[model samples]
Target chain A: MSSNPQLRRAVTPWGSFSWGYSDVGADIFIGLGLVLAYAAGASNFAFLFAGLVYVCIGLAYTELAAAYPVAGGGQYFVLRGLGDLFGFIAGWAVLLDFTIDITLFAWSSVDYMSQLLPAVLASVHPWSHFLVVLGLIGLLCLLNVIGVRESTAFQGSVAAVDVLSETLILCFGFLFAFQPQILIHTMHVSWPSMFGLMQGTSLAIVSFVGLESISQAAQETQRPASVIPRTSVVLILTILIYAVGYSNLALGMQMWHPVHDAHGHAIAFWQLFPGNGDNQGKAVALLSAQIPYYGLLAQFYVPILGAILLLISANSGVFGSSRIAYSMSTSKLLPSVFQRIHARFRTPAASILTFCGLAVVVLIFAALPQLDHGARAVYQRLFHGEDGITFLGDLYAFGAATSYSFVFVALVALRLFDPMTPRKFKIPFNIPMRVRGERVEFPIIAVIGFIGIFSILVFTLITHDIGRVAGPGWLILGVFLYFLYRRNKKLPLFRSQPHDWRTAQTSILKNAGELELMDEYHANLRASDERKRALR
Target chain B: MIRLRTGFYFLYVALGTIILVRVLSFGVRFETITGIVLGILLIALGIYRLFQVTRVRTSKR
Candidate 1:
C-alpha cells in the first residue's frame, strides 16, 4: 500500500444524500417523542421554529461545503475563517455531540428493539438495557477499527424505505384519523409554558443535528461542488417536512392505544407518547403503528426498521468521532497519536478506541442514576428526575447548538475573508459590501441563524440540569487538554498558525477531481493579484 | 444516472404538489401555517432542482 493513501471520490449523489439522511433522519425517531413530551401540543411550532433555523444552517453548509469540499467540515471552515482557538472549540463541541450520538442512538436502538422484546426496555430493565447499549457501542467500535463500511446502495435503499414509510404514515394518518379542529384544540389547551416551549424548541434542533454528515462526506463525493448543493437542499427540505409533519400528525391523530392516567382513565395520544419512556425513544415506530390500515403491517416492521436506522446512526457516530479527531490531528489541533492508522487495519485505531471509550464513560455517567439507588436519590434531589436518554439528549442538543452557532459565524467570516474561493451556492438574501477593497456578500441569514442557535444554547443551559453542568465541563476539560498539548508541542495556544489556505483550497479541489473549480480558483487568484499589482 | 436524477426531480415536484394540495384542503389556519410554509418551500426546491437539471442537460448538450 502507498504511504499517502487519499480518500477515494466514490460517494455518488445518492450516496451523499443517504449519508446525510441516515444521520439526520434518524434523529426524529428519538426527537419527536422528546419534543412531544415537553412541547406537547405546540410540538409542531417547536419543530417549525428550529427547522427554519436549520434551513439557514443547511444553506450555509451547502455554500461552504461546495466552495471548500473537504472532509474536516465545520471545524475546517471555522479554522479557515475564525482562527485556531474558535476552530478547536467548534471541533471539540462537535466531538461532544459525536460521543453523545454514539451512546444516545445505541440506547435508543435498544429501546426500539424493545418494542418487540419487552425484556430490554430501558425504563423497566435499566441495567440490562445499559449492558446492551455498551455491547452495541463496543461492536460498532470493533467494526470501525476493522474498517467495515456499509455500501452506498444498502444505505440508499434503507433511506428510501424509511422515507416512503414515513410519508405513508403521514398520508394515512391525515386521511383517516387526523382532524384540524383536534389539532387546533390541542395546541390551544395543551400549549406548554414559556420555559417548556424554550426547552422544546431547543430539543427540536436535535432533529436537524446531523447536517454535518453531508459536509463531512463532501471530500469523498463525486463532483461535490454540484452534488452537495443539490443533495443538501433536498435533505434540508425532507427533514423539515418530516419533523413538521410528524409533530402535526401526532397532535391531530386519534389515539390508537389505550393510555391510562393515575386513576386508570383514558388519556390522549400526545400524553401517552411523551409520558412513556420506551415509546419516547421509538416514537416514529409507535406513531406508524397507529396509522389505521398501514398500522397493521407497520406495527411489525417499523420497530425493526427504526432499530436498524438507529444502529446505523450510532455507527456513524463512531465513524464521525474518529474522522473528526483524525482531521484535528492532521491540522495539529489534536495529538498526532489520533492520526496514526493501524498497520494492518489501516484505520485510526487510537482515535476510534479513545473516543469510543469516552462514549462508554458518557453512557455510564448517563446511566448512573438508573443503575444505583444512591445515585438516583442524589439525582432526584439535585436534578429533579433522572432519565438517561433525556440526559444524553440534553448534551446532544447542547453540543449541536454550541457548534452550529460558531458555524453560522464562520460562514459570515468566510464570505468576508475568503472571497476568492468560487462558491457554487451562496445562502440567499446576502447584502453586498466591500471589506478592505474586497467585495463581500454579507450573509444576513447567517446572523439570523446565529441568533436562533445561540438562543437554543441559552435554552439548553437554562433547562437541562445535567447538560448545563456536563456540557461546559466537557468543553473545559477539552480546553485544558488543548493548552497542555499546545504547550508541549511548542505551538501557540490562543493564536492561529500561519496557513496558506489558497493553495490548500487548490489542493483540495485537485484531490476531489474538480478541475473546473480548480481552474476557477486559480483565475480568481490571478485576477486579484493583477488588481493588487495595478493598485501598487 | 441522468434518468435517475430526472426521476428524483419529478418525485420532488410531485411530493411538493401533494403536500400543498393536502395542506390547503384543510384551509388556512394558524395550526396549519407550518404545513403551508413547508409545502411552499418544497415546491420551490423542486422547481429549483428541475431548473438546475435542465441547465446542466442543456450545457452538456
Candidate 2:
C-alpha cells in the first residue's frame, strides 16, 4: 500500500457506524414534537412514510459513498456527479439545515430544562428566551474556538446509553400501554387530510436527516467499501424503527390521556399541545412521562438525558456549519473571508462568526411577528404551532429534503455515467444498460429515492408555509454569491473541470485495490495532456 | 458467481411481484397514485434484471 500522510484510514466498521449514530441523538427529542404537531393521530403513518424514503436515500448514499468516498457528505457526491452549480445548491441547502440545527437544538435544550424548572419556562417573557438561546450558541462557539472535540469514548458512551434507554422505554411503554383497538380508533378519529399527511411526512424526514454523517465518514474509515454498506443499512433501519415505533406509542398514550378543550370536552392532543406552545417544543419528554411504569423514571431521567444530548447536537451544528463554510470558501464557491483562520486558536473563526450570525438572524426572524398578516395567516393555516422552533423545523425539513433529493439524482447519474467504480454494495435491483457501449447499471433505488425525496420537497413548498419562502430566499442568495465569486475569480459561471472527475475516480479506485485500473487511467490522462501540449 | 447472479435476478423478480400484488390489492385510490407508479417501476426493473440473467448465461455458453 502506498503510504500517504493524509491517507491514514483508521476507523473500523463499528467506528464508522458510530460516527453517524452519535449525530442522531437529539433528532428524536425535536422530530417527535414537530410530527405530532402536524399529523396528530396519524404520526405513525408519517414516520413509516418518511422511513421508507429514508431507506431508499440511505442505500443511494451507500452506493455513492462506496464508489466515491469523501468528507463533504451529499455536497461532495453531487459536486462530482453533477457540476459546480448543482453542487453549490446542494451545499448551500445543507448549510441552511446546519444553521437551523444549531438554533433548534439550543432552543430545545432550554425547552427540556424548562420541564425541570418553572423559572426556565418563565424566561420566555420579552427577549429572555432569545437571549438564552443566543447565550447557548455563544458558549458553543467559544468552546469550538478553543478547539474542543468530543472524545470518541464520550460519543460512544452517549450513543450506547441513549439507545439502550430509549429501547427500554419503548418496550416497557408498549407492553404496558399499547392497545391495538385504541390505536385503530385513534387513527380513524384523527386521520389527517392528504396534504396534512404529506406535511407530516416532510417534517418526519428531519428525524433521519443527520445520518449523512455516515457517508461523510467514508474516507476516515478502514475498508470503506465494505463498512459503509453495513453501517448505513443498519443505521437507516434502526432510525426508521425508532421513529415509527415512538410515534405510534405516543399516539396510544394520547388516547389514554386525551387533551381537554375549553368546554371540558376531549380533543386531539395536537390542538391543545401547540396552543400557547406549552407542549409544542418538549413533546418527547411529556410522552416519556406518560409511559406506565417508567413515568417516574422520566421525571428524573428524561429531562437530563434530553438536555445533554441536545446540547451536544447543538455544539456539533455550530462547528459543522463553520467547517462546511470553510470548505466552500476553499473551493472558491464563497468569498475568501470565510476561510480566514484565527491567529490564536487556528480555527475558522470568521466562518464560525458568520454562521452564528446567520443563526441569530434566523432566530430573530422567527421571534419577531411578521409585518404581513397575510403571511402569518397562511403559515397558521398550513401548519399548527406557529412558533420559533416550528419555524426552524420548517426550514430544516426544506433543506434536508432538497439536498437529499440531489444526492439521489447524483447517485443515479453516477451509476449511469461512471460504472466499474468499485462498489462493495449497490442498492438492490439495478437494471443493466449499455449506454454508448459502456456497461452501466441503472439505479432503481435512486429513482424511487428521487421520487420520494422530490415529492417531499414539493410538499415542503406547499405545506411548510414559511419554509417555501425562506428556503428559496436562501437558495437565491447562494446563487448570487456563486456568480459573484465566479466573476471575481475569472472562471466560467457553470463550467465543470474534467480533471476533478478523473482524480476522484482514480483516488477511489486506488483505495479499493484496483491499482492497475488507476494506473492505466493515470497513464492515459498523462498521454492526453502531452498530446494537447504538443498540439499547442 | 453465475449462481449468485442468477439468484439475484430471481430475487428482484420476487420482490417486484410482491410489491405489485400488495399495491394493487390496496386499491388504486387517487391518493395512492404514487404507490401505483412505484409498483410499475419495480416490475420493469425486475424484467430487466431477468434479461441480465439471460445475458450472463449466454456469455457462459
Candidate 3:
C-alpha cells in the first residue's frame, strides 16, 4: 500500500460527510428552545456551567473528529479513541439522544400544528397529531430513500431559515435590556431549585444535540477539514443566540416567580408566553407575535423568531434522523433489506421507514393527555404523580449522561495508552513535555464531558424514585445482551464491540465470505472505493 | 413493495403507535421485568427486521 499523506489526510480535511449532519446546529436550538420555553421552572446554574464545559468538550471533539475525519460517528470514534465499554456507552448515548430528540420534536410539531390549524384538523381528527407526525416522518424517510443530497438540502433549508430568525432574537434581546438588576440580583437559587435550574440547562444542552449532525455529514462535505471548523464556528454563534439570548429573556421575564390568582394560588406560566412589564404578559404577547410589543423590529421579532428557530431546529431533526436510520439499516443492525438504496436517490428505503416509524411512535406517546399537566400532583389526573412534574417514561437522567461520560473517559484512557495515533486537529491541552502539546490531549476535555455526563446520571438516577434496580438495571441489561449476543455470534471480536451494521460488515469481510451478507456485498463492490483503496 | 400481510404489519405498526401513546399511563413500575420485557421486544423487533430483509432481497432483484 502506498503511504500517501493524501490517504492520511482522508481522515479530517480530507474527510467527507453528509450535509444533513452538517446543519444540525439549527435544529439543536429548537430542541433547546422547546425545553427552555416549555420547561423553565428553575435556574439551572449547573447546566449553564455544563454548557461552558461542553464548549471545551466541543472543541476537543472537533479536534479529534477533524484529525480522524473518517472515524464515522460518535460511537465509532469513541470505540476507537476510548475503548469498548466507553464506545458502547457513547453509541448508546448518541442513539438515545437521537431517539429522545426525535420523540420530542414530533411532540413539538404536534403542538405547533395544533396552534396553526386548530379547526377540523384538530377536532375531527383528534388523533391527527399522530397522523401528522407519522406523515412527516414518512415524508422524511422518502427523502432519505431518494438521496443524501435531498436530505442535506432539507437540513440546509431549515437551518438557513433558523439562522435568520436567531439573528433577529440576538439583535433584539440585547436591545430589550440586559437588566443587570434582574439578571444578577434576581439571584434567589435554593439548593433544590438550583437542581431544577440544571434541568432547564439540560434542555438548553439539548439544543446542542445535533452537533453530531455535522459529524454524520462528514462523508458529504466538500472539504471535511474546512467544513468541520466552519460548522463549529457557526455552532458557537448559534449557542450564543440560545444561551445569551434565551437565558436573558427567561431571566428578564421574572419567569422564576410564581403566578398568583385572586385566590392566591400560585400558577406557573411555562407553556404561556412572556408577559408585559408583568414579564408574564409581555412574554405572552411576544410569543403571540414573535415580535416584541415593547422593543424594536428586531426586538419584536425575538419571541416570534425563537419559535421560528425552533421549527427550523425540528426540521433538522427530521432530516438528520432519517440518515441515521439509513446508516443503521445499511449496517444490518436493523435488516440488510432496509439497506437498499434507491436506484436514483442512493438512499436507504427500509432505514427511512424505521426512522419515521420510531418517530411517530414517540410523538403519539408525547401527545397522551396524561402527559399534559392538568390538576393533581398525585391521584385522579391521569399519568399524574404527587408532584406536578411528569417524569415521562423510563427516561432516567443518569442513563443519558453515562453514555457520553464513558466516551470521555475512553478518550483519556486511549491517549495514555496509544500515544502515537494519527489525528487531523489535536486539542491544545497544556501538558508540559510529552511531545509538548503536539498531540492534543483530548482526554482532559473528554474527561470533563465524562464528569458532567456521569454527574447528571448519578444525581438524577440516585435521587429519583425510578425503582430500586432500574438505575443499575438498564446497565445490567446492556452487559447481559453484550454477552448473550456475543455468545450467539461468537466471532472473537474485542470486548463490548457494538454489533451495528458497519462493524458487522467489517467483520464479515475480514472473515472472508464467512458472513453471508458480507459475501454478497463484497461481490457487489468488486471495484468499490474501499476495495480500490485496500491492500492492493 | 412485496406485500406481507400488509394489514398485519399495519396492525403491528399501529399497535406500537397506539400503545406508545398510553405507555406512560402504566402506574409506577414495581419490577425489573418492565425493562427486561422491553429488551425482549427489542430482540423480537430485531428478528422481524432480519426476516423482512431476507424477504425484500429475495423478491426485489
Candidate 4:
C-alpha cells in the first residue's frame, strides 16, 4: 500500500458539473410522473415551490463545498459546524439517500429500458425486473471498485447528449404542442386537494436530489473553490427550468398519441402518463415522444437515453456512498474497515461492497411488495398500497429532506463560527453581525432553506406511511451502531473529538494545490488573532 | 469544438429571447410568469457562457 493515500484531483470544471448533472438531472425522468400523479394540475406549483427551496439548498452547498472541498459533503460540514453526534446523524441519513439512489435509479433504469423490452417490465414480471436491477447494481459496484476515470468520461458525454436532447424536446414541445389556455384551464379544474399538494411538493424535491454529488465529487475536483460555484449555480437553474418547463408542457400540450381514461373516455396527455404503471417510471421518454415531429424520432431514442442516464445516476450512488463512507471512517465515525483502500485498485473496496450490499438489501425490501401475493397484501394493507418505485421514492425523499435540513443549519453555523475559511461563494442576502467578539454573517437564505426542508421532512412523515416508519427506523439503527462503535473505540459518544481545524484546513488547501487560498486563510487568521490581542 | 460550443450558446440566447417574447406576447399572468423567469435565466446563462468563452480566449492570447 502507498504510505500516503489520497483522491487524485482529476475532475475538471465540466467534469464536476457533469458529475452533478448526471445525478440530479436524471431525477426529472422519474419525478415528473410522480408529481403529476399526486399534484395533478398543481404539479407546476409543486415543482415551483420545491425548485425555489432547491435553489437555496444549492446556494448553501456551493458556498460550503467551495470552502471545504471535501468528500463527506453535508456530513463533513455538519461535523465541523455542529458536533459529532449531529454530523453522524447527517452522515447516516445521507448514507440512506445514497443507498436508495442506487436501488431507485437502477429500478427506474430497468423500467425505462422495459419500454424497449416490454417483457422485463417491473409491474408485469416482478422477479425478472428485480434480478435485472440486482445485476445492474453488481455491475456498477465492480466498475466503481476497479476505477472511476473511465466512468466519469462516460458520464460527462451522456450528460451532454441528454441535456441537448431535453432542450430540443422542450423547444419543439412548447413551439408546436403547448397551449397556455390548456395549462390555465387544467390548473383551474384539476387543482389537487391540500394533502395531495403537500405530498406532491414532497415528491417534487426528488427532482432536486443528488445535489450532494457536487460536494461529494469536490474532493477529486481541480480548483473546486473556483469551479463549483459556476457549475453549481448553472446546474441549479438548468434543473429548475427543466422541472417547471416539463410540468407546464405536460399540462398544456396537445396529445400526440391518443390516450384513454379508465372508463374509455379520452383524456389529456398528462392524465395518461401519471398513475399508469407502465408510464410512471419512464415519464420523460413518454413526454419526449409527444413532441410534434420530434416525437417520431424521440419515441425510439428517448427511452434508450433515459435508461442510460438513470444507470449513470445509479453509478453515481455507488461512487458517492463509498466515498462518504471512506470520509466518515477516516474521521472515526465508522469502523476502520470502511476506510480500507485496495492496494492495487486504490479504491475504497470495503465501503463500496458494504454500502452496495446495503443497497441490495434495500432493493430486496422494496421488492417485497412485488415478490409474493401475501407480502403484497400485507404491504398494501399496512402502507397504503405504496410499493415498488413509490416505496423507493418515499425513502429517497425522507433521506434527502433529513440530511438537507441539517446542511442548512450547518451552513448557518459555519458562517457564524468558521469565518476564517475563505468562502469563494457566499449565499446571498446575509445579515452581517458581531457575535461574542467574532465577525459573523447571518445567512438569511439558509434559515429560509431550513424552514423549507424541515417542512418537507414533516410532509414526508405525514404523507408517506412506509417512509415514516422505515426512514426513522434507519436512523435509529444507525445511532445504535454509532454508540456501540464509539464505546468499542473508547471515544466520546456525544462530545466531538478535539480537532485543530486551522492546521487541517492548511493541509487540505495545500493538498488541493490552492496556495493562494491557503495564504488568504492565513491572513484571515492573523487578522483575527491581532483583533483578539487588541481586545485583550 | 469551440465554435460548436459557441454556437450552442448562441442558440440558447435565441431560444431564451423567443420564449420570453412569446410568453410576454400572451400577456403576463400567474400561469405565464414561470416561463418568464425561465426565459430570463436561460438568457443569463447564455450570456455568462459567452462571457466565459471570451475571457478564456483573451487569456490564451
Best by DockQ: 4
Predicted candidate 4 versus true structure: per-residue lDDT over A324-404, tens digit per residue: 898888888999887787877778888899989999999998898788889889988999778688889999999999999
TM-score of chain B of each: 0.88, 0.71, 0.47, 0.92
The global C-alpha lDDT for each of the candidates, from Candidate 1 onward, is 0.85, 0.71, 0.43, 0.89
Q: After superposition, which runs of candidate 2 have C-alpha atoms over 4 Å from their true positions?
A: A1-15, A146-152, A219-223, A254-261, A265-276, A336-349, A370-385, A507-536, B1-61
Which wins on TM-score, candidate 3 or candidate 4?
4
- DockQ: which is higher, 1 or 3? 1
Clashing pairs in 1: none
Alpha-carbon error at A492 in model 1, in Å? 0.9
Off by over 4 Å in 1: A1-3, A148-153, A262-264, A343-345, B1-27, B41-61
How many steric clashes between backbone atoms does each model show? 0, 0, 42, 0
lDDT of 3 by residue, A1-536 (tens): 11111111122321222233333333333333334442353332433554555565566556544433432356655666554555544554455455545555444444444444557343235456456655655655555455554444444554555444554443343344323234333333212255445444443444445556555555445455445765564364445334433443444333323457678875433334211111221232233233243343433444333333334444444444444444433332223454455554444445456656755664554444334434333334433231211232224243345555655655565455444433345555545334322333434566566667566555455434532234356556655654554466552335544544345434523332224434444553453434446735
Q: Write the per-residue lDDT of candidate 1 for residues B1-61, one digit (tens) a residue.
A: 6666667667656665776676677799887787677667656766887788889889999
Q: Cα miss at A531, model 2 (Å)? A: 20
How big an interface RMSD has model 2? 8.9
List model 4 lDDT by residue over B1-61, tens digit each: 6677788788778878877887788799887777787788778888888888878777988
DockQ of every predicted complex: 0.46, 0.04, 0.01, 0.54
* Model 1 chain A poorest ten-residue lDDT run: A1-10
